[model samples]
Target: MTVALASFSKEKLYPPAFDPGGLVYFGPMFDFVIGAAPDGSLSNETGALEAWEPNDDASEWTFTLRSGMKWHDGEDVTADDLVFTINEFASPDATCGGVCGALAANLASVEAVDEHTVKMTLKAPDVNIPAQFGPIEGSIMLLPQHHVEKVGWDGFESDPLGSGPWKFVSRELGQSISYEANDDYWNEGHQPKFKKLDVVLAPDQNTRVAMLKSGEADLIAISPDQVPVSQSDGFDILTVENTVFSEILFFKSSDPEELTHKLEFRKALALAIDMDEVIEAFYPEEAGKRTSGDAVPFSETTLGHDPDLEPYPYDPEEAKALLKEAGYDGSTIKIWTVTFPDGPEQKDVNEAIAGFWSKVGLKVEIVQSEFATLKEQIDKDGFDPAPGVAVTGFPTSNRPSVLTNMQSLMMSPDAGGSYRTYWDPKTADTLHAELAKIVDDATRDERLREINRELYEQYWSIPIAMKNTLYAAGDRIDGWEPISGISKVLSYETLRPTE
Candidate 1:
């Protein structure tokens, strides 16, 4: 089987350093301790751990590995490997953000209770422990301790070893990677249906669609705009809705004189843009839907999602009034648009938003750049002057809990590594800490709703739309369904061929 991806990272193929795109290339070669099920819920059924239970206070957890599991190198998957992996994730060197950061913050100690059992003690109770460690885009994966001890990080990257359904065959930098099926895979029912897998990088959307049409690829990720054409071409189209949330982030400025620092100004910016028009113009009906601030669509399914919260109404007249009340001087407000991999129409969406703002008598400038360059700039020169407002997309499919999403986008930059800097760190951090300690479902859900309400009321960021990921499969493919709510981590093992 061959798959074409929209992007690939040139960085080393280490799980710790992987972005969502990197996961598509290397994820199949490694197994996870817990993962998102097809129904968009977290479960240990498909992971190395057979069962897990928490102690009386929910501060300590015990994970029992499935018996007879073997690593790619033939070593038994044991509690020692789980301990090593968790310790590494907590280490200072591990990439910390999202769930990884959550684990690092709460984990007090991890030990190998026996060959098949691992015990983890936390500094404080966390009801979202499973979610924090599940195989989401930003979460870490279980590593082979023996392989790493023998070869080190560099060597492991060169020749990765894992207990996944596929084994590393070969690769070409920035071009393609190949893997062979692991016939001896522990889970017989979930073994790869195909014998071999080849993943190629075709960053351009047109190029990827062309490859799919020409029968050069079995599957390709595509934009919504290409859906009509692909469907006409008789290719099977697969879609997963509410996978990514595209929004405009308001970066905090210490200078109160700046428009972004003013509450009315932020609200004005939110109300000016007409999301319905934007969706109609750039996306198909099934591909996009308006969303409330910091919350993705289908909020009912996501924990902490507030049902009453609605997207800011499109009221240009009110927006103009608010702008006037804020004493706007019509200064040029730059909205940075990035060539993000997951957001194919980001430039178009930002352009439409700029037009809306212009109609409201606000001076808006669209500054275009690559996502990498923009990220580098933000990292180097903390949010102060530049990046006043930028258009970007975030994956919201962190299963079993939405706190991970809230932590990343709503929490203070110092605490959550959020790109948005306008939030009050002390207040957001305190709220998050409180939410983490509660174990009751009803209490947790109520608190989550409160957080969402707070973000919406404050205009934390301009909620735009929830985007559905589209994919086209060739005729040779049969019975392949992507896990809902996750845009990354294409479960190649689940793909079946036409018999």
Candidate 2:
């Protein structure tokens, strides 16, 4: 059995509606209806489930589940789980807005027609329906409705019930939580190899690092800074390139022709980013390497991987000259960053961008706030996109909320589609409509792939380097491979103890 150890802070666990930071302790205790595969393919890459066909464009999606699966609770996991999950996320009453709400805004209704069948009808066609099934995104691992519906949304989260390889055993406020294997788990025949698992909240990086070093902890999510010294610490390293992209988002609420929308400015900003140095500063030579692709490379669909969009040549002078030509002697640009959990890399990225703009003759002012503060500032009617450079993504559709949310809905949570820059609604709508007209999945993927090109070619917003997620897992663990964000870090059931 695996004896993996992790440092986690559980200020809360949930009905999962409100807890974006989910059962940080019992993550493996749930299963998704459909999953994103390691290669970024949605809907079963693990030899688990087969692709089900869609009946019609009523936007109703039908999934025929693999048979014989049951909840860890020994109760049958029926179509109801899938139906409940879909309705929960689509309902404004849902606590979790996991990224599905925006993409599936056209969802009209959902129903589990039978024990093994689930059907979802949309207000409009959404090609990204399958990608939204995970707990990380909006569609969640099914909750034991008997328990949740009985307790209601508020109470159900505290004592959530689910069917997984493990069961929720005990939780101790802020310190740690533990889970024991479900002896009667439905997948008992599949043979989940571990007997028990435990997660503890160790908020301090140094403390977490020490816990791992001393064998008190077996895994820790790494920061770019911790990777360097972590190299010689005698642990095997696993790198998972993530699908999330962090960029210098531009709101451009005031600048109409968006002179700042120049490719030169985006290119200059891209060029000015010294990612390698920043990576080196935070990660060991072995862990730090430059990565590309508009989003994580794998998710870019072959068409999105445009060589023309490569990282800018690192030349501050060239950048300055470009700005000069644009008549930008460096007007004030607002720089927003998360302060409470400031890692060296996040801080460095902000400072570098600010200083680079300054060198280019722009006045730079730094604004440090937590993710919430920045989000609040950003969601406002007049939020300036140019001022914030938050790391965000539309993992479900590979579309940028920074683009959609701002454009159509004026930054309202209910915005239809657009980025914070609110680049162009008519254009995005046209592109999406064009893709919908194409019936084949391959052709549709190709159509979706053009988002990056349009973002850069049309100067919708600034594009930054796509990143790889680096999680520190001890070599003693096996099979729970870090497959990017393509699924919840492989199923913990696969993790077998090693000596």
Candidate 3:
């Protein structure tokens, strides 16, 4: 009844093991022992985790395990599979991990206790341990030991065997991907109702929308400008807040004489832009509003979001004055935007932000690049010339216990996430000490908040409006809502046909 339209960049189906980004689609198909919903709510939203505990010390974690769960291959679920998978995935020789290196650091070992029980002991008492169990326990899909042991974890190329709701049917690179529902899925409580799903690799929005309108595709991610057409086409519109944002980058160290590090200069630009207008110009009704910090929008944890943290709202006059006080009359700024094909409002949004600086006497130059290009560029540039400004934000499990990530970003040369603020010894020592604390969750969260506050206060990057992570379902679809900052997009079982 409901047909959903989605676009993929390349038609290649790589092994999920080596492909971290590829997991985005495969995630909903597979299940994790832990996860988040689209709303930023926990799968066990009540804060009641049936499998693990948040209050426990990082040195020891107990997974109570779900009863009667089985892999897609009909292998009886056991604790040993989890232990085997964890050790294999987190091991250093391999892992398509964003956090596996760090998660692996704390994990001393993973061992099965009983048939449905596994325990993890850490090398130290970690305060931010719950962060490991991200929206889907912060790891990718749990691998089935039966298959991976034979194929080898890293060698399972193009063969994605999992205990997920959908099984891979066929794939044609740069063309299409088809999957069939798993009738034997153990977690039937959260399985998809659809018999089949197809993901066509069409990067152009015009092409995608055309396919949707022509009924060649049943559902498509509608652009704000195309919302009317979607409604006219009788497609259901779903919009929700997203943690993603874009920004102006400056490798200030490259030009120490530049105003990139000047607080007033940053504040002026922040105050000059009308983000609401940016939202309107690009996103219209489907636009998501931003919060004070880079925290996910519409989070349960964002209830106390400081309403007073005001953004500069198109006051070119205020912006001009701020720049003057900072001794910045006018200097050309090179701005870069990272975008993916078929992503939302990308060009208009980037252009709109650049326009704000231009209005207030700032010379702005824009550079745009594809996802892979951007990452490659960043890898090459690193801290040598930090992006004058770059837009980046990740989905959160609960407020992103960012200390672990922040510390790693700031300190680890290997990980080299943009925390590359070259430092005086005093500044370095102070920030490092704050990061190395071993404490309880309550204490750790407080420290983490302070770190986030400092990052914003220091004007590391301008906090643009939080965009909504959206998926368009047709009118024939029901029981779907764009959840808040909760992790994971949709439960496969939640997709019931409307008509």
Candidate 4:
């Protein structure tokens, strides 16, 4: 049996490439060796790694591999393979971006302890170490060391080898990608029921929906607005609250004396916009909830979230008063957003924010670009200190007690992307470093609560709302589950055919 799904990608599949353009095509081919357990802890159910423990004052970590795991070529998986994959991430010459680069920032060394065991040393102690290998998108993905070493980086891109349930078969760029189930897959009871898998690339949302309705596609991703209109016949609409926070960032300019760098200016801008209006305009009534105070909205479930803090109230009058006190010289402030696949048009939301800011006597300019271009600009040198505001979703993790989200989203540019925060970078980094050393639950909780309060009071970044991810599946598809770790992670592993 063959299962057909709709995926959006403009290029062919390329494994081990950290570029966003390549990651879009990598989901079906690669798998995170470690997966999150039922309670949001790390486990070895996927046979990526069976067990791991920290030693040497929490600076060194030892990992034990699961038995009987094999690569697509039928080669036995070993600790050497794991070491090689991590070395690629830790290499200075790697052109990777996003989570791969962020995680690699702290990797000091990786050594093979034995055939089934590997040990990793870190530059600093981190309580969120396991998440680097967790099932989140952009986390570490295991690669076949033999193939990569023989063919080299450039050659391996064209001939990718993976140990996941699916094996790459063929691809027609911007059209479709094909894969066959790994019959010799070592992991038991979790294999895909289908013999063959085909992913049709349809960049248009309407075309994807039409394909699902016409039986050309069995499953497709759709926006919340399309859910009500597309859920009539044999389709099942599955919704999951994403571990992502859609927020507006206020960047500091290269010149420290810029208007955006002023605390009063940033506070007034935050006060002028009504989050309820923004949520109601772009999101369906049941799709998104109003969120404020937290850097990542879903972070309330994390350890650092403070429940007692209140969000900044929406008051245009107060905004105007603050602006008056700051010396009334009108200047056009810039805001940026980009287009995304099967999601709300963020450009529209930015325009609404501009309208709100304009009412408070602030001149606003909404800058738009493609997602790829925006990411490139954010990663470029001196981009962090550039003066402008941009709108994008901040990614959080599913780990219940981890500080990975906090360190990535707010602490430093190396952990987080190059996005600038409202507070002093050095001070924020120092505070987070101190937080990382605490292993006691009580001490950690108290420190986290204090940091959460500071984040709210300092207005680091203005959080807009939490987003809901929606997927459309057909009647023939059964046993399908909502995505857990990251959006679109391991979706095929849990699916089976009803007919």
- Candidate 1, backbone clash total: 0
lDDT of 2: 0.52
- The ten-residue window of minimal lDDT in model 1 covers 391-400
Candidate 3 lDDT over 327-403, as tens digits, reads: 87555566555554233566667778778778888777766656566545545643333323434322223344544
Q: What is the TM-score of each candidate against the true structure?
A: 0.94, 0.82, 0.82, 0.90
Candidate 4 global TM-score? 0.90
The best candidate by lDDT is: 1
Best by TM-score: 1
lDDT of 1 by residue, 1-499 (tens): 9999887764466776666656778888887777667877776677778788887657889988888888887889888989998888777666645556667777899999889999999997776777767665345678998999999988987889988889999998889999999999998867899999999999888898888878899999888788888889999887775677776676553336567767788888889888889878878866767664444322555777766776678899999999998888867888877765678788778888889989999887888877677666766654444424545343345344766665675566566555544445567677767877787879888888776777677775676677677788999899775677777767888888998
Per-residue lDDT of 416-486 in model 4, one digit per residue for the tens?
54555444666667765786677665788788777777666666567776656566787778756535545
Query: How far does residue 39 in candidate 2 sit from its true spot (Å)?
Result: 3.8
Whole-model lDDT values for every prediction: 0.75, 0.52, 0.54, 0.65
Mark the regions of model 1 whose C-alpha exceeds 4 Å error after superposition: 253-257, 292-298, 386-388, 392-400
Residue 257, candidate 4: C-alpha displacement in angstroms? 2.1
Q: What's the true lDDT of residue 326 in model 1?
A: 84
User: Which has the higher lDDT value, candidate number 3 or candidate number 4?
Assistant: 4
**How many clashing pairs per prediction, in order?**
0, 26, 30, 1
Worst 10 residues of 3 by lDDT: 295-304
